[model samples]
Target: MNTLTSSAHLVNVDIELEAAVLGVVLQTPGKAADLLRYIQKPTIFYHSLHQHIYEAIADLYAQGNDCDLMAVRQWLKSHGHDTTNLFNIISQNIFFDLAPKCLILFELAVKRYLGQYGERITRMASDPTTDALQLLERVDGDIDNIMGSIQSMKRPSVNDHLKVFLNGLDGKAKNNGPFTGLSTGIRTLDEQTNGLKPGCLYILAAGTGVGKTAIAGHIVKHQILEVGNAVGFCTLEMKGSEILSRFVAAETGYSNYELDRGKGIDPYKINDAVTRLSDKPLYIWDKPIELIQLEYQASEWKRRYGIKLLVIDYLQLVKHSMVKNRYERVSEISLTFKEMAQELDIAVLALAQLNRDHDKREGWKKRPKLSDLRESGQIEQDSDGVMMLFRPHKFGLNYADSSIIITPQTLEIHIPKWRNGMPTDEDYPLLAYYDAPTNRVGSVPFPDVPF
Candidate 1:
């Protein structure tokens, strides 16, 4: 069997493999549409002819037209794509193994992507004027694109989506009480937000010294750690060791300060906490990351460890090169984080900072508005829900005044914008204990639960 292999001069693309997939699709158009749709992108093919051929067949099938040789040939001619190359894949030499053929082409496309990007990186590196840090950023973005293309190309069809919906609708997904999403284990917060649902993006925005990270740690320790659902906690603000120390503090009821300094806390309590947390599926990445790189890594976490949730320490820290203006950059970041949640079928909880505009509102009234989402209004627009944290006690409000009716120890979780269910009370926020020394946030004194 003579395979139509590409000449050595061309990029290392499998011409025969591309032809094989095309031949199989041309011969078998009955199951062709889904097959082509699974391929998703025509750019996977090495040859321009194969790319157009796939598109023509896909278009024919999509329009409820029969994709016979005559139909495909005519479509190609009408679209101004070459028809002479059609003869290459018209032969009966190829097997009708559609999936395997497509898989090979997918792999080849990734290799070609790497090679192309590698050459570009080398060229950029040779240019002496290029800023070293900027060059590194561009190179990382290019690599991320290659990885992202693989996940993007695996896009599911309508029927594929129908199965997931029907599976849950028919009760095959099982009945687990009132909520169906990943339960944050805070009964009130979970009940309100429906447990940080999949395909939804939640923003935890607050002023500095607020209990945003504490509550996030509590949720992870109490729920995710308990259920053992893998969570990818991307910390842009803090180091892995710092986050881990806080988690330990939350667990052992020791201050993160003492835990880090190794002074007041007992070594055995830290050991016990570490041992218990050892089995939990929590992955922490503590470094600055660009948007594409972050998305690529999250996808890898979803693939490798089956991460059900992604917690970004602070939204503004994730770098973006596409836009020069801060507002546009934040807008892009927020939108991509939202898309990533839907794409990976996971919940994204991004910690963000509220603008200082809230500070002028007087004592015990420093509550953040949706409009106060730091750099862009797009964060509020893109989010499924926005949770803002406000600790009046942090402002040195020693006692609960009659008007405010809150103490310094009390942590107020504000739900100014909730898309799922409206339990938002701007005037009076949800009540929780900060437990500062322990670095824990919850109703507190839970004998059974983790936090």
Candidate 2:
């Protein structure tokens, strides 16, 4: 019997544990399927013979057949493998008493994997040509893989998950709580999404000059100023000063042009805006950052300020050095955002650019769809909610209500995909007014049809 050691040590095979698990499975064929819940992959077994035996059992189980010793032997024989020696060893070493320790087997497997990954990373670091940032990302990915393996061993069953969900519902009802997530300040958007739930990746997509940044700023400001939630905003497109100016314009109702040009701006109002927002827990990283760097920054913000929400201003601008191809890089970034949201237990709202093909389309065909997300469809698939900003007036469509056509054009926020709730179809699009000068967006009453 081999004792499991710390993960820092070199990995060794645990033949005793492997034999015990396989013996129990052979004794009770039904137990093979149950064993899979703890350790699914055959590679988790340290011994080659044990790996073969596990694979045979898994195949039989998947085929809806019993996996007793005879069946396993027959299957191995049919595959031209001599299991006589393997069966003898199993019979001699069988210890059904240790069947409950299968979890320990899974733990050892994870530890072994991590130890191997550490060696690989050390080798990579020794190479002078290896990019430091790329190496860091690779190491982070390996660690995530190791952690995922450990988590899988203890993952709850469907019934167990249902119980926890029902308990949450009961608690919500008892406490008379309605919103389970942070509010976006748009009433209809909040109602439709039940606010932005933690562990969700939301995509806010729009074409150029469609006020995506304005909408994201509005949401972050509402979170930090009104709801008193900490937020981290990462802007790859704009500088920190520019973002701050927008925030000030949005918060104080000052014209962005006036602020930018330093003309006709009241000094007192600017001072007041600065003083009011000085204490808000809003952190911004406006420099160009890769996905890994953003993850580190977001984690630090959460650790330092307990930030509850993270906003990435325009996903297309995020850089990744590991993958050279634009499409694959974007796909990796999108998946990374989703994983980061879930791992950090924070809501991530990422702004994305729509493809230029939408602009080439004719009337009504120009509206952005899920497929129009630039670079990769992974952005649309990975997002928990996809909100596409559309302004018909931008395309020279006149508003029937002439008053509404003035500054702050009517903006239609089309949600093509909402994983938790209903999506916007042809008939319904969330209506809002985008005041570009003030860097603000607010909900508007749905106008009559045929406009």
Candidate 3:
């Protein structure tokens, strides 16, 4: 009966609300499976009796038994839960508004957990041996553990998604041009990848100073302003201000040089860029973050801003809470990115670094291969698409071998691995315009596809 005064604010758990939700579940056995997915555990119920009731219902449903009144009652009796309490639940006339009530129950359960967590922290703080800074970090982690449980994902049959897939296809044909998923504003990329779609993890890999962050900046701007979708960008390599400056440069067609030195810069254009971006739905985290912390913040970003996409600056930089084996850590990071993309129902665009192995290769093999992905094993396995950027210009090498003249500003995007669609021919990678001064990565209709 403890009251929680936290942001989620649960005054107390109501026994009646528990009974009401159970009533709804018992009346429809098929829906009980779904309810279990959403609520997760039966511990959401306040009283022990109510918890037992939910457990019995779930147990019966799992065994292919109908969760009707008589069946549930018999199971409860067999399991030793009082049948008299079942009548109290069955008598509840509330059938509608089950979702909201379940949410409330879930909130109460969260508060209960927080209360316990706070007590543990209190006991630790009481001891002088507990480091204050460590304790503070523990609090942050504890909160993430509690709040992260709010989102529950269920595995649905492929048939369940058939209508959605068809509708999406129809919408793309009628609404957007060849982009069934979230568009990148780069028509070539969108046309190729079908836009950064849900349930997909896209890895944009390149060597150092190869314009990964610059391209990512362009993408988020496109997603937020042009596509009218919110985006979250977390950078482990750069500062928040640096990302913003890149955004401003992309916005105003000013180079990073002009923006930084303020030489021959038009203040009004910068002002205009700021004005346009001020209200746009974009979240940025500049500093390095652990995998858990990034997930925590990403979850909050999704809840508050409804971000359709989350861009992690570079994969290798994502840390584990403690230092672990580099390969194992990166592997874990890669798989987590994929899971986060699926669980949050958002597109994950993770920028990654290519390994030195590519540099050791001769000829066109010098361009990154799927194997060149740093910790390539899991990254290649987990990503729905892997795009490797090769800038021969960056390495003082030119595409003199190709029919088209390669300038220093040219960008070669080699999509070596893809699941949603096959990549373009190996020799003919997607060409893009890299305006270093403006900090923008622009793409045109790529004509170099194998017939």
Off by over 4 Å in 1: 1-104, 107-162, 396-405, 444-451
Give per-residue CA lDDT, model 3, range 11-101, as digits (tens): 5667767777887877765456446645657788777777887888767654445678888888878887777656666566666645566
The alpha-carbon lDDT assigned to residue 440 of candidate 2 equals: 71
The digit string of per-residue lDDT tens for model 2 on 182-285 reads 88877777777777888899999998899999899889888888889999999888887888889888767778888878988888988988887888899988
Native-referenced Cα lDDT, model 3: 0.77
Stretches of candidate 3 above 4 Å error?
1-159, 169-173, 396-403, 445-451
Q: Least accurate stretch of 10 residues (summed lDDT) in model 1? A: 442-451
> Which scores greater on TM-score, model 2 or model 3?
3
Predict model 2's lDDT versus the native.
0.77
lDDT values for all models: 0.76, 0.77, 0.77
Residue 129 shift from truth in candidate 3, angstroms: 63
